[model samples]
Target: MGLRSFVTDILPTTLHTRGRHAPTLVGEPEVETFAQLVDKLGYLSREDLKQVRAAYKFADEAHLGQFRASGQPYITHPIAVAALVADWKLDAQAVMAALMHDSMEDCGVTKVELIERFGSPTAELVDGLTKLDKLQFSTREEGQAESFRKMLMAMSRDVRVILVKLADRLHNMRTMGAMAAHKRARIARETLDIYAPIAHRLGLNQLYRELQELAFSYVHPWRHAVLHKAITRARGYRRDIVERVRSDVDKAFGEARVKVEVSGREKTVFSIYRKMREKHAGFAQVTDIYGFRVVVQSWQECYLALGVLHQLYHPMPGRFKDYIAIPKPNGYQSLHTTLVNPLGTSVEFQIRTEEMHAIAETGIAAHWLYKVGTKSSANPAEVAQTLGAMWLKSLMDIQRETHDASEFLEHVKIDLVPDSVYVFTPQSKIMALPRGATPLDFAYAIHSRVGDHCVAARINGEPAALRAELKSGDVVEIITNPGSRPSPGWLNIVRTGRARSKIRHYLKNLEHEESQALGEQMLTQALRAEGMALPPESAPEGTSVWPTLLRWSGNRNPSELMLDIGLGRKVAAIVAKRLAQLMQEQGQRPDAVTLTLARYAAGGEEAGATPPSLVVVDGSEGTGVSLATCCRPIPGDEIQGYLGRGEGLVVHTGDCGVARRLSARDKELWIPVAWSEEPVRQFDTDVQVLLRNDKGTLARLAAAVASAEADIHHIDMGDEARGETAELRMRLSVRDRQHLADVLRTLKRSPSVLRASRVKPERPPG
Candidate 1:
């Protein structure tokens, strides 16, 4: 029988309905009438179809009373979704998953129950389709992030899970017109931002197209309607152009002795709208709105067709791409080229082999062909890798490291971004990263250790900044320093959340260690001031020191108590008193004079008998006593500490405007703080110098500051000045206030110096 005759004859002739129960299955019932559907799904045997049917029946029974917002039976939605998956010729398990997509959420079906009924594979797919309703989150964004996290992690486990989920989402999006306006908008936005990109990444072209069209309609309804109308009208006008192009391409290929199938392809409404927005053009200004795909039998014919097309029209300059040689990360392979036709209109042409066309159209779904056909050469691993399923590995890693749902969601979003660049490693392997990612992200992409020790990088054989934005096709090589660690400043510029989070985790632990040491030292000094001896490093197994410390700080353990004390959550005076009590209980008594001095210090009076100890203010330190970034206080400045909520004691200069305002309003928040006799590290001080606009003036100023035993950390000069004076903001390192004063004096004595003053940078209230 001819193809048309077979299709027409196999079409359903009778309609059956379970009146007042299930709706009648109407139109094209070839599967039930003649088992044509089973015959066509060559990859699935009769046994597989029987299993799938059993799953469908189970899901139908489970969701018997449930209905969707549109008032249709819930089982219909899953059936439709499953049909869509079957259309992709996915595996039997994936089809079963699609059929039961809503069972867990709507019918109270549990994963364990599904596993017992449909096996682990089907249960896992259903689990992936399940949303995060069980997880508690403070905000809608957090919940959404968490749901996405769960979905992506599931997808990483088995690519089939996402395929089924995408099918489920696609069916819902197709029927979204029945949803509320606000819900439709939100769902559409999410689809455009996430699901569509995921489909594209998986090389599900048909699914991607459907998702984009549905999302565009809800996101920009009016624009979408207008574009649809315009496309319809344009198609009418271009009917002859399409035919002419098709005929010329056919003839040209014939002349070149290359067999090809030429077909006209119209641009989708979403594609047109995107082009118009990106190029800032009106509908009429948009070229390449219509294209032709030339599917040939072999890669050689694809190249031959490309040459034939170029000879047929004036090829546009720099408008050709050879994707066949290096398929996109999504595994899309085609020879794309744009040409100016005889009518002076630009048109795009895509040339590809029949197999490439299949892959391009179905994406990773094409891998199923191996199961159906005699060609069993397809590599499942390669297909999975090409579809970017490796990103799922990171999801597992993220889950292992982070327990916060919100943070997990954030990591998933960072990893799911569609705009990615594929860069080459030194070993010639490819690493994918989001657009605007830097070399540091790339290093981290390879391995966390590489990122931690990455001191420098080279791009394409030339030295580049670690923060340099990577582009597609670039070869990057990381240079590591063995002793190097991730810098705190890197957090400000790193694009990937993984890199940022890892850096923060490292810094937090490092700061805690330093703060513990500092706390220990401060406790020792305070004890010495009380004329008491230091405690032993390790207490006896049954000693009460640990319990005493925990009671004093209201913490569960010694580490927590120490961290609280170091963070200034517990005052030093209070902790010292508790320590003294514990020591007295241990039969250690303090001198009467020492007790008097401790009492005086607790009452905010100076202990003249004891000298003040040293406290450091290096940028490397992180404790409750943090120097305000806004002020960058040096040792010479009179600083006070503010015990902020959650934040420990934030130090600010006494003269800082912010500190003055905070003290005026909340005076009790401020605590007395004095610089140590010998600061452990250099301090940052700001100096403003007004210099006459003269050559070598900045050099002279730098020399004068250096002459005073100070090093310049940063310098900011104003743009062109109106008069002879130019303002310069300089950050200098000094040991003490006297050192800063000496630097200021030397700057005032410099030549061409119009004015000089200590610039007190404003500090943020803690």
Candidate 2:
């Protein structure tokens, strides 16, 4: 028989009679059994069914004799998942992929083979679904993170990948009863943390709730059982109330001459459990456990029915929300209100149109139901796709900025949270953000450039701190300075992942650039000690010198080598020595007179003895150089530089006890450093004072420090004075050692002070 004739004529008959009425079958009955189920849907063509059958046969053969933990044929699991995808009305490719999703992972089926047989789209879907178990990782979490990252990337590219994967996960979660307790708990937690949130984000509300229910059952079985029993008893007692509310709502709508459908909507067990946990209440205290869903014919009718319901029952104060005007981030729209029933218990009602009801239940899956022409002639599939598109773009944006797999996953998890607050821009455009987001997050949401240059903000026409948390309906305006850059402190205040990633990316790039410049300066000083000039890559004669040096150092490029040197990953003197040798080989001999003078100035260069290169500290080196907090060295403090690995340069006081201990073991990492003629910024150092317990002692100390032109960054005072004296420790920012000495003298002159001195690390015992 022909393909169409077989499907149209024989398939339905065979399905009815369980293959007894079949005329002829082209594949195994097991494959035909599933194909027959899909054929009954009348969604796919005969050609599509043929391809699906081919995939099933191939997968079944690949997983031949394999059984699940429940001892069911492995092929049965794939069949069930494929049936779920078909229920979604996805394309034939998705259905085929669902059937063979585990073939590549469990069986030896190769993507190439699948590609040759079923085509590229189906093969790619299977490949995207496969986990990264075969590869090795240092930790199990790392391996799982990488696998999830790959799947997210794939899903962002093709939404169907996730659709099929969710179906697969749903089936697995359903059959998890046969697995070991520990394994079930682990899978349940993963589903709760990742998969369930993803589903909710995608607008797959039905799948989301089901996954949450299943995961909660596995993660906390005892709680689930207790909660289930409580809900069961509550349902029996509340059955009359539910019916009465339904009847009353029906009559109210009828009297108002509106066409509507009223149905009893009960909260899912998981939702009820969550509410109890969040509110710290028992089951009886959860008044909105039983609700009603009013489906109207039109958006206008939805509002009209809302009025009828309010007149029927007393509406609860501050319990009405109009989401239709401002839909949720996931595109869910409804009018929610709570009312006190006759029994004095709260009853919630969700009022929406038929179309909104569909979206509310199915989310993105509602796209299929709205594909045809509707009253508005707008395709909800496009609307759903648009909603998903915004988040997908964010995923790509975050991926571009973050290269580490675990870090990317972390950012995604932060974004997957469902609570959001809507605020407005100066132009009246509404922007929805995660709850607890600050004005910096708003700026970053506007644009990365805006975020980088943001200096301050004005909320509701009043000046607001940049770290101020934004509330719904606030009109926020970001103040930008053309020269401003992000500060490291912003990372602690910003709440959104996008802002966090952008700030980190900017800081990382800034640090790298600064490090490169410092490394070049250090390398130049080292080369000068060898009586050779550092070669410039742009110059024709010096091009070979850098490449030769990089090859010898196993570095890929000059920038990377410079960055390494600046980050203290490589010693500048060693690279300079090797470069000098290469330059001499090219017939460029060192100037003997200059070499002698340079060596003499550098304290004599010996084999393996790096001459002390005097690097001036001007207090504006950014992250490439820092003063050790333990020593708190300022200018003119007899300072030495320590090149800590990956920590750039750390300046320490020459006699700092901490520095002395480090120098004992890492003697070679030390380099000589000097103060500049002028310093641009003040340095912070610790100061201690012993003061008599007087009412104005702190005020006198503050006045003393200010009179000496020093700023106290922080102050610490212990609780209550012991005997007659109290010790005070404060961090003060000063210009130099002379300024610190001046502050010490001023502090000692105070009547409340018995002694004052710079706080230093205690020395180790001999």
TM-score of model 1 (CA atoms)? 0.83
Q: List model 2 lDDT by residue over 1-766, tens digit each.
A: 1011112321122211111121111122433257455654478888998888888888889989999987888888889888777777777888899989999888978889988998998899999999998899999999999899889888877788888899898878877767887888899899999999999988888888878877887787767767766766776687677667766776777678987776665676678988998999988889887777788888888889888989999999999988898888888899999999898889998999877888787777777655522446665445555669978888888888888888888888888888888999999998888899999999999999999999999999999998898998899999999999998899998988888889888988888898888788878878887889888888764887888888898989888988998888998889889999999888898888868867776665455555555688998777778889887888888889898889888998988888888899888678788788799999899998999988888999999999999999999887864668989899999999899999999999999999999997667567
- Which residue pairs does candidate 1 place in steric collision? 636-737
Question: What lDDT is reached at residue 508 by model 2?
Answer: 84
Q: Give stretches of model 2 more than 4 Å off.
A: 1-41, 108-113, 372-384, 527-532, 538-549, 577-590, 604-614, 690-704, 719-726, 745-756
Per-residue CA lDDT of candidate 1, range 262-351, in tens? 766666778888889889999999978877788888888788788888889999998998888767767788999999988788999899
Query: Which pairs, if any, clash in model 2?
Result: none
The lDDT, on a scale of 0 to 1, for candidate 1 is 0.73
